[model samples]
Every structure is written in structure tokens, then in C-alpha cells.
Target: MRRLTKIAAVTAVMALAVTGCAKKDTQTSSASGSSDKGGLCASGGSGPKIGLAYDIGGRGDKSFNDLAAAGTKKASEDLDATCKESEAAPDEPDSAKEERLRTLADAGYDPIIAVGFVYTPMVTTVAKEYPKLKFAIVDGAAEGDNVTNLAFSPEQGSFLVGVAAGLKTKTNKVGFVGGVKGPIIDPFAAGYQAGVKAVNPKATVEMKWLSDQADQKAFANPPGGKTAATALYDNGADIVFHASGLSGNGVFEAAAAEDKLAIGVDSDQYLTAPKDQQSHILTSALKRVDVAVYDFAKAFKDGTTKAGFDVYDLKRDGVGYATSGGQIDDIKDQIDSYKEKIVSGEIKVPNTL
Candidate 1:
């Protein structure tokens, strides 16, 4: 794969400074509690109050929650909404989660977004308490008249990544590392397996599910991911696709150290990984949580947003790959070709194990 030229050191610093300034501005605006802006969500006299609750991993993982935060920040900036967020500490109690929801509802937030599947039950229960308030949950479904569930077809994006891995692997051997063995990550593994089989009928894919859900420590343990990746590579699997959240960081590290390639999930992790490790990152399978949040916020602002399930797939450009860092250029043409096949019904990506 062709590596994009690195920005000059001074330019990189300047860029970081500018980003820091912008984040500071966003934090200041959010902190000020003003509601006059009209970008994504509307406020009633005090601006729209948008509340977000994160899963156990919290923010700064450079993955799912961070992507969702980008959307919330955009909504805050465009809609002049006051955004409030809370992180569920690792292993938070059910009562605490409920209390957090009630606190946000009591504070008058119109649409409270629960960031992951873990928040489904809490969101469903809270929506019943605040019947007039709207709620959005990503990666999970919540049952209520006021709740809107947003889910991404990662199976679709993963299928494309599977195609890339299938064509690019010289060894004809690939691997998958999942955070947990559950409904959320299973589609990624299943679709990847299908994609690999599509291109290379005889290619063997080594599958590893990091979490059995028997031990609660699976998804957050990077050392475990590193050990798993090392084992996969030792078994002759050269390219690995990981949906392990923070644990996926260890997969990248192992790949970089071993001089192999790895695929990322949720965000454009090529930018998040160390520079020396950039070459090992082939591409990322992106689920547009940011776009979903932004669109729904816009709907709420316009009074046209509906309640119920909203599913985003490749056909809608809601789930796809990232082009940033120019990391995907080497295979760009191939990626486009596969995308067309998928969109035209020539290809079907499986959604289950």
C-alpha cells in the first residue's frame, strides 16, 4: 500500500494546535449553556439540550464513542444546542445508570442519545418515564414510542474489507479479532468470512472472539488482544481485521511490531495509530454514527424526525470505508468496484454468524 506523505513536523504541530483551539471553543460553547445557534438541533429559549451517555469504555478510545462525540459536537455547533455527556464508569450499577438518565431528563434535554448497546435497557426504561422526550440509541434497539434506534450495517462495510483482505493477502490467510462474541460483533466476522470466501473459495480465515462474555474483562484488555494477534500471526495469518474496540489497539501494535497489516473499525484509525505503524494499517470499516446523530438532530430541529428504527447501509453511504491519510488509495479502485457490486445487488453481504 502507498503511504501518504507526512505533514512537516511544524505543520503537524500547527494542525494539532488548531484542533485544540477548536475543541476548546466547542467546550466553551457547550459549557456556556447557550442555545442561540441553529445548526443541527434547536433550543427552546435556552437552545436545545442534548444529552449523551457513553458505554463502559467511555471517551478517548478513538473508536465508537469518539465518533459519536464528533457528531454531537457538530450538532452543538450547527444547531446552537447545549450538549451534556456522561460516561458510565467500568462496571457501573444499574441504579446509577438509571439515575444518570433521570438526571439528564430532569435537566430538560429533549433528545438523549445513548451511545452503545449497553444503554438499551436503560434508555427504554427512561423514555417511558419522560414520555414527551425523544431518545436515540446507537448500536442497539430501545422499545418505546419516543425512542429511535440507529444501527449500522457493519456487515456491509466488513464485506468490502474482506474483499480487500482476500485480494491483498499474499499468504491467502486472514484473521478476525472481535471484542466480544455477541450480536454486535458477530455480523462483522460473518460478513468478513463471506467476503473472503467470495473471492478465494479455498482461502482459510482464522477466527478469534476475544470475549466469550464468560469473563467481563475481554473487550478492555489490550494485552489479551496482543497475545491473540501474535498467536494468529504465528499461525501464518498475515492480515487481521479487528472489531475489538480498545482491545483493537493492541492488534495494531502487534501488527506494527510484526511488520504485518491490520484493519481497523468504527473510526479512521490509520490517523490514530503511531506514524511508524501507519503502513500496517490497510484501511478502516466505518459506521457513520456521526452522520446518523447529525441527521437525527437536524430532524429534531425541523420537527420532522420520526420515532422508531433508522438503519444505515452502504447503499445510503451511511456505512463504508475511510479515505483520510490516503491510506486507502492503493486499493481505491478495487474498493469502488466492490461498492458498485454491493449497491447494484450483484453482491450480498451476510449479516449473521
Candidate 2:
């Protein structure tokens, strides 16, 4: 019966592809027979087929999308799965996103993962047509029976970063640069502001968004980020935390040239930035999207994964701060203490804009 069930699942997937229900424009075949060697495939059968659609900035931003990719890579390595990825244009419209999701689905990917909140509508529309097909959306939630929404409580980590920035700033002034003013970018700014106020009530936090709410070019505009960082530094901000995606690279460059410090988000960007400018990195507010993706893949492989909204927080080690290269040693103890308070319920980090 177990063998028959396994065969049935594979047949269903192939049948869906043959019927042209899901239309794909690209397809690649590998001679390597499916095995559990890489763990992308399940034991005693071919691996699961996974698809990932990256956000506007794609990979290499050293932030949200990269972390999601890391998780997908891990799943591919450990679960014996076949993984496919697509990069969307930054200004791609909803129709393009919908077509991409359908293409991946038609290509026989069981669980097509969308890496950012921007893919919410696309995922929702695609998920409805293929009831048996699984879908995962990161950084945002989709309300559908077949979709699993993975969300991170970034404020929990941002609060800790704010604490670090507050304690380490010699000039008692810091700045926050966001990619744009939106539901996603606001949490980082709000949490950092709250954290700064918690430590130094008088510490002035200079807040700037690279673009207004209507500016669609916000996430990928590196020059704007650099300009914002320069303006902030000139305005007397000794430390800055940026949640600006690829634009944050410009912030790091500006900080390095001006001999100031900057905090990274989503990943440990100290390594992503130039080696010479690493000294300017204070710490990073980490969002463990990779872990979530890996866990979801494992659960799907084991037939234990459920479809719903899965929220990860500091309690589950899903979000926190990163200390690497001795950049945060000066205030490590303080950061740890704050972590304890948060874990022990003494500190409640607010999740709001």
C-alpha cells in the first residue's frame, strides 16, 4: 500500500503536467537518476520538485532573498529534491509574476516558493487552480487552502539591533535607512526607533526612506541608498541600520568611505560587504528565512508538513541578532542580556510600523 501511494503521487504530478493545466516555457532534464543522495528526493523514491521565485532584487543582496535561497539550497542538499529558481524583474507586473508561478507549477514543481511579500497575489491566484500542488510564501502570508505562509517577526530581532546601535554610538545619534515606506520596511524602522529609545532616551534617530510610497524603484536603487547614507552621516549620525535591500550596499559604501558604522539586516552582511569596510559593521538583525524553508522542505518530505500560516519568532530561534568577526564584542554582553529579557518575557518587542 505504501509503495502504491508513492507511485500514485508521482503519477498525479506527471498527469497534471501532461494535461497542459500548468504551462511552462522552460524545462531541463538530468541524466542522473533520482536518488536520495542529495536529500532533495525522498527515500525509496524520486525527490520532490521545488521551485523558487526571487523578489525584484533577486539574489546577492545579502538580505531577505539570499537567506531564502540558502534555505532552498539546504533543502535541496538534505532532502533529495530538484530545485528550480526564477528571477523576476524589479518592476515586473502582477501578470508577469502570475505567469512565472504558473510556469514553475506546469514544470512539475510540487511546492513553488515565492520569496517575498510582493508575490502574495501571484501565489494566491496560482495556488487556487492546482489544489494538490503546494505553495509557500515568505515574508508575507497568503490565505489559501494549499498555500503555507511563512512570516518572520523581524521586530523581535530589530529591537535587539536597535539596542546594540543605541549602546555603541559614541555620538548618541543613529540613522535608519529603509528601502521604501511600506508595510514591510516600516517594522525595521519602528523597532529600531523603539530599541534606541529604550537604551538612550535622548538618542536622536534620523529616519529616511530611499523612496516615497509610490516609488517602485526603491529596492534596487543603490545610488539612492548611498546618497541617503551620506546625508545621514553628514547630519551627525555615527551609526546607521539599513533595511534597504540592494540599496543597502550603497549605504555600506558610504559608511566605509566616511569612517562610520552601519548595521545590516536579514543576513550577516559583514561578510557580504567589502573586507576593508567590515570594521564599520556593528551587527546584523537576522531573519532566519533559510531555517524556515529547510524545515518546511523536511516536513513536506516526511509527509508531516501542514498548510497554514507559520510564524517564526525569537522564541523559536527564527529571528535574532548576529555577532560575527568580533564586530559586536564591545556590547555583546548587553545584547545577550537583552536577549534573555526578551526570551524571559521581561521584554516585549513591538511588531508595528
Report the C-alpha lDDT of model 1 over 121-203, residue by residue, as the tens digit.
78879999999998898876677988888777888888888878887787989999987776677778887888778777878
lDDT of each residue in 1-353, candidate 2, tens digit only = 34222212211000001111111122323322111122222222255677778786776667777777677656655665657667776565789888888888887887888887777777878999888888888865565888887777787788899999898888999999988765677777877888888988989999888877423457777798889999999999999999888888888888999999999888888867779878888888888888888788787788776776687777888878878768678888888888889889998776555
lDDT of each: 0.73, 0.74
Index of the highest-lDDT prediction: 2
What's the count of clashing pairs in each model shown?
7, 10
User: Total backbone clashes of model 1?
Assistant: 7
TM-score of 1: 0.86
Q: Which ten residues in a row have the lowest lDDT in candidate 2?
A: 10-19
Superposed by TM-score, candidate 1 places the C-alpha of residue 313 at a distance from the truth, in angstroms, of: 0.5
